[model samples]
Target: MSEAERVPVEVAVGVLVERDAAGREGRFLLTSRPPDKVYAGYWEYPGGKVEAGETVEQALARELREELGIEIGPAHPWQTLVMDYPHARVRLNFCKVFDWTGDFQMLEGQQMAWADLPVQVKPVLPGTIPVLQWFAAERGHSGPTHLD
Candidate 1:
């Protein structure tokens, strides 16, 4: 086995969701990758790596605050998936965040969109595809989840 395969980068992902008064999950947040970063322009959930001594939730909060300029509320633990990319193997920890304070801001010079099934965004990130499927299953949605 190759040496690089042994260590996976741990990332904390925030699936920020909005719920209606009836409490049904509504629109979720998607952010375009920064132009200077990998997979630039591809849309994905917002979050970043879990630094040393930081928990997934901590990382999620920090990343969201730094990247979006919002203070997130309780983050419900969701799914965890490990994806193999050519550049690095990443363990993505996805958390569903339903409440937050402050207005949205693209602090990283990225675009943010709120969308539901048949997600209107184009060029979804590879790691984000499974998340779409997860959402589909939970929402009982059929058909394509997003554009290629």
Candidate 2:
């Protein structure tokens, strides 16, 4: 396909799970994409697109289980951001999980870390950063879209 004709598009969702740290709450999990994949080496929220026949919640639960080996409970809509990249456009839905099970383990051989939102890292994945900042500012996923 021609470069201009190629459809550069993708859909992804991010899971925002927080925990109390040192008596202060508001921490989210981020994972590093493997060096061999697209946007690799950059830190990103763990999620993928919503596939046909599957709801957003289903996609989020599946992605979390597949990528992090954690089984998530009910998740509520957090935020949605559409981003455009050189190769594709991504519609990212950020979800918040109030409950889950299992230890946080990397099912895809990626590195996972729980950090305070609005991370200090320079330039995170375009779609994921916005939600991250929202999480940091609000200290949760459910809130108004003041920073979008």
Every candidate's lDDT: 0.93, 0.69
State in Å the error of residue 96, model 2.
0.9
Candidate 1's C-alpha runs over 4 A off are: 1-4
> For model 2, what is the alpha-carbon lDDT of residue 128?
69
The candidate scoring highest on TM-score is 1
User: Residue 135's C-alpha lDDT in candidate 2?
Assistant: 59
Worst-scoring 10-residue span by lDDT in model 1: 1-10
How well is each residue in 1-148 modelled by candidate 1, as lDDT tens digits?
5845568899999999999999999999999999999899999999999999999999999999999999999889899998888778899999999999999999999999999998998899999999999999999999988876
RMSD of each: 1.3, 5.3
| Backbone-clash count (model 1) | 0
Report how far off residue 3 is in candidate 1 (Å).
7.9
Per-residue lDDT of model 2, residues 40-125, tens digit only? 86778888867788888888888888888888888878787767677666667677776789998887878876766336553366
Worst window of 10 by summed lDDT in candidate 2: 139-148
Residue 73 error, candidate 1, Å: 0.6
